[model samples]
Target chain A: MRRYYVDYFLIFLGSFLIVYIVLPIAVILVLQIFDFSMLLKALQDERVLKALKNTLITSTATMLISLIFGVPLGYVLARKDFRGKSIIQGIVDVPIVIPHSVVGIMLLITFSSAIVDNYIGIIMAMLFVSASFTINSARDGFLAIDENLEHVARTLGASKLRTFFTISLPLALPSILSGAIMTFARAMSEVGSILIVAYYPKTAQILVMEYFENYGLRASRPIAVLLILISLTIFITMRWIVGRRRYA
Target chain B: MLKLKNVSKDWKEFKIENIELEVKKNEYFVILGPSGAGKTLLLETIAGIHIPDSGRIYMDGIDVTELPPERREIAYIPQNYALFPHMSVYDNIAYGLKIRKAGNIDETVRRLAEVLGIVHLLNRKPKTLSGGEQQRVAIARALAVQPKILLLDEPFSNLDVQIRSKLMEEIKRWRREFEFTAVHVTHNFEEAFCLADRIGIMLNGRIVQVGKPDNVFLKPKNEDIARFLGYENIFEGHADGSRVRIGGITLSSNVTTFGRIKVAIRPEDVIISKSDGEFEAKVESIESFGFASKVTLSINGLKLKALTTTSKIIEEKIREGDRVYVSLRGFNLL
Candidate 1:
């Protein structure tokens, strides 16, 4: 008797979910393609191309930096017990919950002092907010690995670092890759923080907002539409590469 | 040669207290006990993974207590084998030598893998291999290092019966062929019997007895040791200066105990016959093993275990309701 109610409830919830999440995206997608000239103007702009390049380079750099630092951090969190471990983990996840504007303000306070306003400031802001994704994912990946793998390597005469690089890293690759992708995506969409810390060299998200504010809806719509298309394209390509690796 | 002198380690809930052991060069030393005896802790201590709070670890007379694993030069294969899943079988075997910057590393790895019958599995990763194959690769990887001593903790417990027996035989053969010294720890007496040149019986983190497997089984140091060794014939009896008072009967024995004492006897020592003896017992039931049949008997409601040949059981025609005269030819008093 209860099973029937459960089935009906599940169907209701699933349909509601489909309508809730997919409806707005469907509307925007249809408007961007069907309304024609908006897509044309977005594609032709040199400023849009520059923003695209900036976003791609900064996000990619953010992801690379995250992987290099995050894998070890994840492994330590997953495998070891040390003082302040839980506190350190909580610290790693702090940026994700904070407001984007707040993150931007915090970066400005720290980086506006002349040492970090260059590439360092941009990269650090992106990493601060996005690296948590990689760290958390890598932690899960490392946790899934059987500890016996590292133990065996140690017994076989491989040093701790060698065992980590040769065994732990490969087995945890899927998770690390997922984390990197998440960080990349998060960094690419960053606008509020980049605006405060490094606004002169505009990212695509900032460009879209700038066009919308300066020149009314007509001039701004094309850039907004362009930003969305380019972001989606890069996101889809990353997913495809990771998906292939999974099968392999 | 491996030696652990006054070794003590505490692993949260379990503590191995003052464990002292020595495995001679080329000796197959097996540590046997029930659960929570800290057998695995002893193995790990020798492996240098767990440092003892108070002990001196010596390999071939050199003190290596404070040495890191690489400097200690001990190879340890845990129960799970800990195979590196990312590396191919060939790379896994080659890892140690590659790091140590040794010449002819390929030759060494290839030779060990071939000996372990894992040469054909060289290119495959550990996850692609079966349990038995992975176990062999783990062993091969350890053997490739050619450490002074090898520690194996429950290496056979993971395999199925069919594979376990075959692997046991292969492991024995490999040990003899390579002349490698090993310290194996397990709860199974059969593993201790078949593989060990010498056995150490551990109880509550202490090495209670260390000797040939037969000697330890035949002569347990105490009643608890006897029971731990699967000798389930322990009874509290009184030695009243003349003879000991057991279940409803007093046996004539020269062995003397001061007051209330525990009498331990191996089931194999008790003999059941239809002749006049000092005592009498009724046959409860008989269960058959491959070579031996265990006859359960009742002496004034006190249960006793006796092992006899299957032919003796048949010739005596022992049944649940049958009456038989029981006698003790001899016993090992602990």
Candidate 2:
């Protein structure tokens, strides 16, 4: 009887969690559909489109920068054995744990406040915070490959760099793509750091915050709803593509 | 066509020291060793993945020790058949050619896949294939570019026993058919016997011996080499001519041993008889193998194993704690 009671409690707890977790997203998606006219107006607005374009451009730049710089670092982290590796890894992961506002301050200190006020500041901040995702995922992807494959390619008359591009990169494509998606998405949603560093040319998050602060929920709801829909579409499509790839 | 001179490496836990070996052109050289014996390390060193701390590698009489793997023109196949997962089988096989900027990459992949009997798997992804299919594809991918030499590092270790044997035969046939020179590293003796024209026995990162398979098994230069080759029954005795005097009994042997010599007898070379004979031994244990039965006996306080057929066990009713007469077969005396 005690076992049966415990089992019943577990069942209820699981169902409660499932419902509670899913309820807010479900409510938001449904509520937006009823506000179709507002959604349409927001979508048609040039300001929304401009913010959207800015967000995409910044995210792509961040993603490319991460791939360019972080991938080699990740590969070294995964494959090389040396002193201070743990320390280097800890440093790489600092952005994920540090406060976003503090990251903005750190960028201010490093790049100077004037520099932070420029477009480069936003890109740098996004790279500093979100680049870790790409590095970590690429590291994991490179690590999953057999060291012998590289050796085999080398014996088969391929140089180290050639083997890396041909075998290692191709094999780690799925993980790298997932990492790219994650970095892009994280860059899109970042508000606190960008608000501090680059605020003149408004991003979508900045626009939403401005609307909310100036006109309250009625005016901001449409923009907030628009941002959520855009994020949702990109996130969902990227997840589907990742799901379809062969992970091994 | 391949040579390593004074190659030495220390990889934290494993080390290969001052290793020297050579291979002739078109020879299928197999490095046979146990796990962690530095077989893979040597293969990697040859493939230029790990730069040897000290040594020179020569290929076709030219020094290539410092050359990158690509410039060396060797092919390698790793264990687990490391196929590119995102690419289809055809694309995976064509990658090397495409990277080299070779003409008609499609033609090369198709011909190689067809030779390896993996043509039907061209459109499929690596993960969707069976172990045998994946292995074939990996080999085909390496062979497609027509490298100067091929190196295999425990490539079939993950395969099932049945498939391993079948593939072993196929690889042996493939080498002859294509006149491909290969350096194979494996822990399996059966594979070495099946595929290797010459075998190099490696231990602790050094080649202890390299020769024809039969000679290495029969005439080991040292006790260590003998022990590594399954010569389990090593006994200290005095040799007078072709007979070794052990305790108070003497037996004829093929091994040329003098004073203070170690004599090794294979388990299959001992003959066991019931009833009285010149020598007496007590049955210590009995182990039943599928084709034969092994009976353990203590001959004058030394434990020795004797092999007999299953029918002999049934007829003689051999079991634990039975008195038996053990005779030396006088052959395979290491």
Candidate 3:
């Protein structure tokens, strides 16, 4: 009888969480459907299209850069124990803990002359706040693999590099793919850092903010709805892909 | 053939020291030790997974201490079998041939698979195979490489009794067919007894005794080794010439010693009689073990264990608190 109440309480809490997270997106999606012409207009507008394209390109570049550098760092962190490893992990999470605007300012001061107000600046801002997700996810993935697999490969006459590429990389692909998805999604939605560093080539988030400031809520609501729909579609599709590949 | 001379490794918590071993070609040398006795560590050191801090390893009369695992023609199967989960059975068996670019890879894999009885499972993933099937695949994979030496770490520890025995017989047959030298590590006395050409008893990181199975089992050098080899009744006795006295009983022995000494007697070797014969003892406890019953006898504040057949126990109607006679006819001095 006591367990029954506890189970009911848990169900209530879970339902509350689901509704709290989903209501806003549901409301936005339904609002855009009511004003279908505005959504179509936003989709066709050149400025909106350009901002969306810029967001996509910079987010993709950020994901690529994270893959290039973060995966190897994650492997080392997962497999080896050395001095200052905990400290290095804490440093990797610094961008996540610090304010995004602070990260923007730090980037502006450090690489102002080279990348400020350029396309690279947007990618840099996105990468700064999002690369940690990729690193952590990859590390967790590598941690799940049995160390004996690599040892067995070596005993079967595989060189270290060959074992890493042929065995470790394939076994860890699902986690790496999920991390890439998160990197892309985080990069796509980043705004506060780009606001301080590179506002000229506007991303979708910055464009939404600009419209809301220059205009009223009524004028900017449609754009928000559009961005929400696009992000939701891509995120869900990517998650589905990752889910399918996980068990394969 | 493989040899280790003064091989030693130092972990923070445990250490194996000054290990010396030599395995002849096509001989299965088993190192038997209890858990946490650095058995796996010693095996890994020989496989080149770990570099010994202070010794050399030789294979086929050539020093290969500094060589990496890939450079040495050694195949190691870990305790869990460690099959490549992402690959099919065929690919798992063919992995070494693919890496070495050996000719007729499919022919070799198929032949080995047929011998291992895993020919129909070639297309299935390792996760889909049963434990016995997966082990057969691991064996096929290791043998596919045609390694100079095969190393198995507790290969039969995870199987049921029936399967364990079956796998043991299978491994022996595989070795005969492929003609490979092997170094097997285990803690089970039955496994060591059934599989070893020569047995090495490891205690506290050292090989305390090494010889044929019968010699090592019957003549343990010290109390510790004797205890591990299933000598249940070990007592300190005063030795003078060939006679030893223990707790108001004098026993004759072939051992010629003249001071304090320890005597070890197997529980089965102590003769039990209902009528008066030798030292009298009270039955403290009797535990059944299928074919035999372990009878614990108490005599003059000393506890001793003896093994008697269940039929004998039933015929004598031996129960707790009953008095019996015990004779130390076959025992060894350590």
Scored by lDDT, the top model is 3
List per-candidate RMSD values in Å: 3.0, 3.0, 1.5
| Model 2 lDDT per residue over B1-334, tens place | 9989999998868889999999998898999988999987887788777788999999999998888777888877777777777679998788778778899888878778777889999999988999989999998988877877788889788889999999998997777667888999998889988888999998778899999998787777677778888777888778877788766667876656677667788787788878646568888988887879888889778888778898888898877888888777644444
User: Which stretches in model 1 have alpha-carbon errors above 4 Å?
Assistant: A1-5, A113-120, A215-222, A236-248, B240-243, B252-260, B268-278, B283-296, B307-322
**Against the true structure, what is each candidate's TM-score?**
0.90, 0.90, 0.97
Displacement of residue B145 (Cα, Å) in model 2 is 3.3
**Per-residue error at A246 for model 3, in Å?**
2.0
Q: Where does candidate 1 chain B have its weakest 10-residue lDDT segment?
A: B250-259
Chain B TM (all candidates): 0.89, 0.94, 0.96
Task: State the DockQ, from 0 to 1, for candidate 1.
Answer: 0.60
lDDT for residue A199 in candidate 3, whole number 0-100? 94
lDDT of 2 by residue, A179-216 (tens): 88899889988988888888856688888888789978
lDDT of 3 by residue, B58-156 (tens): 998899988889989999999999999999999999999999999999999999999999999999999999888888999899999999989999998
Relative to the unseen true structure, what is the C-alpha lDDT of residue A58 in candidate 3, on a scale of 0 to 100? 91
